[model samples]
Target: MDENGFWAMIEAAWGVAGGKAKPRQRLSEGKLSEGRAYALQEVLEEEVVPALLERLDALSADELLEFDRILERKLYDIDRADIQERTDGSDDGFLYCRGFIVGMGRAYYEAVRANPDRAITDAECEQMCYLSWHLYHDKFGEMTPSGISRETCSNPAGWPPDSKPDAAPDAAG
Candidate 1:
């Protein structure tokens, strides 16, 4: 997907999922409210990240690094302390939660920055994607149930003896 398509997916998901920094116990709005975590599974990776990776892979090494900078420093910049303070109730859990998914990308971006020529592996990409599951959800607290296990979930996208994901194309290989 192109950047527009990718961003549109996010907009649509947020629209379906209510676009707020926080999510409701169940999505009272949107056609997809019926499925639990439907937005999470569908909107995030099945749709967005792959498209984003496509775009990321097509860029020059300098462009890739710049994209990462803009994403972390500007787009996904959430103050951890701010989220922590809002932990008083479920209504606010999403505020803290969204960061998890963003972090996955951020983690990979940081890795790439460390070595611009090293590609992030497909496996590492998946591990980075899974970071969303660990980020938020106390507020949902059984309200919107899911099968994801924080402990069992592994982000081995960049793993083993040499710890980094495969390159995006311009990075290497």
Candidate 2:
């Protein structure tokens, strides 16, 4: 698909997976504003993926492999879980799905940052986001706000805690 088509698909998939709305209705009802869509595309292409890659670049090959393994584990969990099995059903599932999408976006960013010459394209990011959303939604029914919060908290250093040690420890001690 062309770039615009690809992004549209990403937005639609996110809407559906996150329980935002069906694409047709969202388009007709003016829910999926063009500006918002464009902004999301920009963030994915220019900012998010680049940032992620930068973070990954600082890691050694073994670290990258470990991060990949973590992502794989999360993906597996998404595939096996059934959203409808939960009491909250699809609504809660969607929230969780959105969280996963955000996480995947961060991952793409890391990957692109790690290898600037091999930066991920907008199309690739969109496709990955779509897939991640569906995987989480299908497994979790409706996603919870708590899930989103937890995802946000996954990187505590991003926010930084209150205190730190003032001096270096003696090696001999």
Candidate 3:
């Protein structure tokens, strides 16, 4: 799917699951306390994911692949040490946390992408990491692999070459 189409579905899912209040607002306004964030995470998994999957279910195989690519790229792009540290997860957990950010739709994703401090610690949307996989399997009874890896520290630009995920960025004057 194209970017607009992809984000429209994400927005729809968030609206359905989280009401009219945008996640970016909640995060920026400090409305999502730990308890509220956890509650939102549960709603995302139980409600938003299914809503998104239902929308994705209508796409052709090629569209599904495109969706997978976009989602992978979004997750990969945010796999930065600065962002991951704020989110308080590592490895698969960090990957899922990125998924949660993406699931909040384009505005929220951009906000968090531009500011690592916007990340919500302990809030995760794990099901989002497997969205395309589940849909592809349910539709065609097989797995569909994409060109990118959504794992933490997978993006070269986000991490120093040959450095561990938690390593600090280079110092320069």
| TM-score of every prediction relative to native | 0.33, 0.30, 0.84
The worst-scoring run of ten residues by lDDT in candidate 1 lies at 116-125
Per-residue lDDT over 72-119 for candidate 3, one digit per residue giving the tens place of the 0 to 100 score? 888989988788878854577788889888876776688888888777
TM-score winner between candidates 1 and 2: 1
The whole-model lDDT of each prediction reads: 0.32, 0.34, 0.77
Model 1 Cα lDDT, one tens digit per residue, 107-167: 3223323432221111112323232222222212222323221221122222232422222
Q: Lowest summed-lDDT stretch of 10 residues in model 2? A: 79-88
Top candidate by TM-score: 3
Higher-TM-score candidate of 2 and 3: 3
- For residue 103, give model 2's deviation from the true position in Å: 3.2
Q: What would the C-alpha RMSD of candidate 3 be, to one decimal place?
A: 4.5
Q: So what's the TM-score on candidate 3?
A: 0.84
Clash count per candidate: 12, 24, 0
Provide the clash count, candidate 3: 0
